[model samples]
Target: MAKQFPEISPALQEFILRQRVFFTASAATTGRVNVSPRGTDMLRVLGPNAVVYLDLTGSGNETAAHLRATGRLTVMFCAFEGAPMILRLYGAGRVLRRGGPDYARLLATEYGGTEPLGARQMVLLDIDLVQTSCGFGVPLFDHAGERPTLARWAEAKEKQEGLEAYRRQKNTRSIDGLPTGLFEEDPVPVG
Candidate 1:
């Protein structure tokens, strides 16, 4: 049976922490709906009603753009190893750009001041609803390991065109023409 909660319960938080992979979904008022699989040790549950993830640089920045346009976001996690369960968090999201106070504080306090090579921004979700369901139809898979390709690419790119330059070139706009707010001079407000 599926269940829902107003906020993330303790058990749900533990489940989120154990997962190695999660998926994010968002969409602007128009255009395509974006759903992306995300990995790496970059997500954190700040409280019962809040979660944050370090969004690495990618070929596209749909989530950031979608949040900027609409503020609606959902994050889903499925158990791939043990129990058959799926958890989804529904919320409003905001991007915390690099150099912003919230970004800096989270980097310092939650992440030991270590920023990943291709980190573009942090996405904060003020969760409104938490839901769980039996994931019996989902196939289970064993964890192989983290791939080093993205990290290597980020390092090389930083040495060449530079990560900031690359962001300007590719990540500033979504495929559907929405601004990603990546390079705005003003800091994004966070709550």
Candidate 2:
């Protein structure tokens, strides 16, 4: 059986907290849809109706572009090790770049003293609905180590000229030619 809720329930929150990876999906009014697998300790649950995830610099900025164009976002998590449940959060999101007021406020209020890890953007999702389904077929997998390559790259860049150069080189636009904030005259870091 499937269940739906107006907001995240306590049990759902507990399940979300245990997930090591989640998938984000978004699309514009037309054209291609984008689905991304995200990890690396960058997600947080702000409340029953709000969630935030750090968006790192990548080759394509599809999520940001899609959100900017349509504001629709979906985050999905499946239990791969423990319980047999699948959860999805349906909502709209806004991109908060680093140095922006929203970014500063989220950092201060939600993240506290954590340093930005060269993230190019933060997607603040205002969840409107929560849905759960029985993940009876989701296979269980053993835990493996987190990949350090991304953090290492970010750290090295931070030690060098900083994230701005990297963002300029890699985060300029989505593959579909959608505009991303990377090429802005005054780009803000978002991680």
* Best candidate, lDDT: 1
Candidate 2 similarity to native, TM-score: 0.90
Q: Please give the distance, in angstroms, between residue 62's alpha carbon in candidate 2 and its true position after superposition.
A: 0.8
Listed in order, each prediction's TM-score against the native is 0.96, 0.90
Candidate 2's residue-wise lDDT over 1-191, tens digit each?
A: 89999999888899999989999999988779999999827899989999998788776789988887888999999999977999999999889877777888877777785656866778989999999999999999887879888888888888998877777766776778777764447354353
Prediction 1 TM-score vs. true: 0.96
Candidate 1: tens digits of C-alpha lDDT, residues 32-64: 999999983899899999999999999999999
Candidate 2: global Cα-lDDT? Answer: 0.84
Error of 1 at 108 (Å): 0.8
